[model samples]
Target: MNANVTAGEAPPRAGRREWIGLVVLALPTLLLSLDISVLNLALPHLSAALGATSTEQLWIVDIYGFMIAGFLLTWGTLGDRIGRRKLLLIGAACFGAASVAAAYASSPEMLIAARALLGVSGATLMPSLLALISNMFKDPKQQGLAIGVWMSCFMGGMAIGPVVGGALLGSFWWGSVFLIGLPVMLPLLILGPVLLPEYKAPEAGRLDLLSALLSLATLLPVVYSVKTIAAEGVGAKAIVALLAGIAFGVAFVVRQRRLEHPLLDLGLFRNRALRAALGVALLASATMGGITLLVSIYLQQVAGLSPLAAGLWLVPSFVLAIIGNMAAPGLAARINPAFVIAGGLLVTTVGLLLLTQANSPGGIPVLVAGYAIAFAGTSPLGVLSTQLVVGSAPPEKAGAASALSETNGELGIAFGVAVLGSLSTAVYQSRMTDAVPSGVPGTAAEGARDSLPAAADAATSVPADLGTQLLDAARDAFAGSLHVVAVVAAVAMVLYAILAVVLLREVAPAGGAEPDAEAGPDSRAGVQEDAAARR
Candidate 1:
């Protein structure tokens, strides 16, 4: 059967092509994740090559996220109208092309432009991949295994990014890391056409060009506003940007619900399990995001560790996270995921609380231990919460549900950076004011302060006495920020724990989606068919 379709109709059954399609779909995820963290290691080379200022450097680091966050929903909807396989193949090509450009980017602006483009291309994969996975593994147990493997790979690349980057930096130029994605992407592009199934939307609806435009109008500004608040804090312009984002967002929502086939189905919020899953993803991310950033900073600034050393030392936590994530489903299958979530939160909260007591005059070991506990807490969160989210939705709405899951994570990161990250910057700047050399102007002092941890060693304009004073103050400010942020995150998690306990009362117990779990549904379907046979 030559199974293609008109604009929006039910896709032909994706028999035989299912497994291949899922693997092909996961390719873009690893490619972009690698590119993102690889740049962190490449920044020194980029700095020397581009002669970029600190603010310019911040732009380089941030613009990719801004692009990724804004376009996620846009591309997700685009796939449902067009063929998912077609877009997946197209996005892979774009990602490879972006890498080649980024590798040889002569200027900072050029590099940033390349990354933004990469973000646009990368957006195509999120919906297509989830939808493809849902179609491929309609049986819940198989789907659980598939999602676990996909998620493991996703986190694997993220966790290994720093380590891989360190190695690549030693052997290859900054651009070399970009070239690395090319080799990785080639097979996915080639195999994609042959192996992946094409998904056609079940309903025929206009692509709704106006709603698409409106989405960009609202999301881009809100995401950008959050990033701005992260870097610059809440001022008049930031306040205006935020308000503008909110107003547009409201209009966008109103427009969506009125549409025939909306870009995203907001009605999915009605599912208690789905809602709880997303809430946990967001809260957990806010806590984890804040802790991760603060720990990296603490290692470099307070403990005098190099980025490579700090990243290497942080390996234990990430490694433990892998085990924790892998073990969670099996555990959640046995015990209630809610209490498991609570236990994880309590452990993580204890870890964060341990950091407040870490303002000792001693050293870094205690801080590292605190981070390990915090990171360990995150492992279960990535798995159990996702199980609840993906497991909550019906077959057709998986992509939309998965998109919301991701949206929560992104929101977590944004809020973590805005609220907690800002607190850190403010405390660091205010407390460390006298730490700067009196000889340096206020503008320069402020500039130097804002770039802390990343450029701690290079904050060279201060006098020796002031240098020691500033360094100590910088550490204290960061610790204070860490203390405050951790408390905020911990409180949010604890509340989520209570919510999970109350809301997820009768969740599919452990292995609910496992092969064994699906037997009940299968048996029910068989009974109905047999009754029909008798009739």
Candidate 2:
């Protein structure tokens, strides 16, 4: 009757030991998310210390994500073969070692290399941890709650990353930010094996090297293109990268279909609930990611708050998001998950609507309020969508399913930042060009139009009256752009809300039938058997 040894009969409900293991699994999820945002606050310090060129700075920030996205599929599948707990421990060791290297990196190139290594290691953690959760929590209700807790830790990490970074930067050096991962990871390395169950797919197939290469070829170019478009706009390089990614992607799909034992089971997408859940998660993450970028800029540039202050202001959103994440499972238990998702999206839409009213100089309160409401409302979808995706798949394929969930989330954020960030940048430039002072130097005007931070820097080199004019104009233009983006985000939420309702209407309640009742004969039977085993 051991929870970890469930075999013939129904999987037992998770007990105290499993719950403790859940906490251990959450450690890496939190650290990975924290790593994504922590560096943003320390960039200035690191840039100064390393004497990084603008291009190098971009690489330092981007290479980590590119590596993570590129390697997720390979690592996920590897986990299923090698053992999830084994991969998790291996990743933890690598992450810790990479963090130390990154912390003391003396040159820009070294830092970039360390970050890439960190990303590669980080890729192994997410899917392994999530799949472990699927193996640990047998009861659907407990599974829902555990996933909620897991997701909330991730959100919390992202939310507090800036604060942690700011506090560390204020007291220590930029290197300290990277070192923070060490302590979080240490406990995981020690406790993960002792408290957690090790699970892997039975008779998992060989690790296909070609499929791994194809996945990397497909994802790296696409992500790079998106980042380029965000930073440099549409160009020949971006177009080429995009096209190449698409070509490789098509090949990857064909390869997956042909392989007797593919790296990923493409058949999982045929499940309506799973497909829609991924769509919901993608759009939600996209919307939130774009808004997060805009909000951070707005706080620092337009509102003129310090990094620490802005981080403090964002605390409420994080707290509310935690509440919402925890509340979502219970809500889904009572109502249909589709209704819960739609309701959350609608709430986010309303919050976005509220954001549209924010204007320059005095908009901080409105912005904060709007962010809190939107984050709280949208938070539930992350937990619920992830649950549906992972829950729908057979337990043996949980690692692959979890990897897909993480991959989609990463893509959503990348695209969201690219598209919406570009939109806002265009609007800001247009507004700033017209509003620039009459006798300002061409260099100053160009710099000011690029971004509010650049504008503030440019202001310092001008006459007092000109500096005031330039700063005011830049802030106003940015605020105007924020309004436009908020409206666009609101519209997107509305559309996605409708899609969620229509697509997920038949999604079963927690502990009920499989989400994909209409799957293929083989998949349907496997899903049902898996569900029954858990019950």
Candidate 3:
């Protein structure tokens, strides 16, 4: 009788049916992140083949991210109002076609244009997948685990993309990376509509066209401005662009507050768990995204490892990341999330601290150990915070909830690059100024340093002592800057731990109601009650 009752009580969980759904859903996340990672390894080939100049190379690498970041909120909200599967189908088609264009492009400009289109298509799928996953998993433990697994795939794609790209580049041409996604995506396109159930926005109001435009206006410039600052320097032009972005961003926020049906319901921030989780996510992003790029440089440039070898070094960190991520739900089930999050921050800080000590000679081992420890700490933080944000939001606001989580993530990435990445460049330039005896002018030095891979290549042809001086200066400068970045990350993680404690409620055990399904402002009776109490 008890068994029958338990079977009857099963709350429409994602059965074998939804497992298939998850595989399809994971495709875009994999591809989007894959595209982002593959380009770094492929940049040399792209430049050589297409005659891509420095600025053009930056565009080729960054346009995809900017377009996706700019359009994510708009697309996610639209999917909610329109229909996730419908948009997913449309996005898949556009993505596949753009992949073809990107693969075949003879010029960098054409490839950049194609990549931008791919970004637009990519933006639509992320929110749909998160929301679909939320709806499918009826059990809280499963919901948390599924989200973790989804996130693991995202990081895994980013981690392995270069390895795949390396193998491809060795075997084929520059376009192969762009072509790889097509076969994987084809199956998702065919099976998605037939298998995934249809879901409507809880309140599918007419599309908020103005708010969408405002989002694009604010986020695009801000993201672009930051990328520029990270790649170049904090010059007058970068500052001006950043100010303009901030101005538009303030305007966008004001407009959202005034609208009856805002593109995103910003009031969702009132939820304590949601807000705290966002804070944790932003800081985690800062640490992970900042270190990943910075360390990749350290691994390849300073440690003098091959592209393939550097990627291989990343395996330990990624493995630890997966383990750290999977541990979160289980830990949350037993303890207050405050302690759990604080513990994660503390653990990550230890790793960052170890990373900071890598400024010394023979520091590669320290770097790897630090990276592994920090990766373990951070791997779970993103997924756990994602769960919290969704848990805090009402189910109807899943679109908004997911978008907001991702916004923090992207912003964290942007800010990390701007702050930590800038510090690295500045330190490198300062230390290397007099160290290189090659008599290269400041302008020449800056230009040479712009593409470090090319610089390393250039070093091979110069006089032996001059080459050693240039390489050593570049190496030492990068190491010093990495130390600064590690310190900053450690500080941020420590601050985030304190905030998580003050803000997040004691996490209840896992056997309770699924957090993501009805945890938002639009769905949960508890949140509604809490609001009423506050009023």
Query: Which candidate tops TM-score?
Result: 2
The candidate scoring highest on lDDT is 2
- Tens digits of lDDT, candidate 3, 330-423: 7876776667778888999999989988863478788988999987887656777887766556555666677777778888898887878877
What is the lDDT, from 0 to 100, of the residue 201 in candidate 3?
60
Inter-residue clash pairs, candidate 1:
333-510, 333-511
Rank the models by TM-score, top first.
2, 3, 1
Each model's TM-score, in the order given? Answer: 0.85, 0.95, 0.89
Kindly list the per-residue Cα lDDT of model 1 for residues 314-418, writing each as its tens digit: 777766666777766666756777777777777888777777666733547777777778777766667767656655544444555566666678778887777
User: RMSD (Cα, Å) of candidate 1?
Assistant: 6.4
Would you list the rank order by lDDT, best first?
2, 3, 1
Question: By TM-score, how accurate is candidate 2?
Answer: 0.95
Model 2 RMSD vs true structure: 3.0
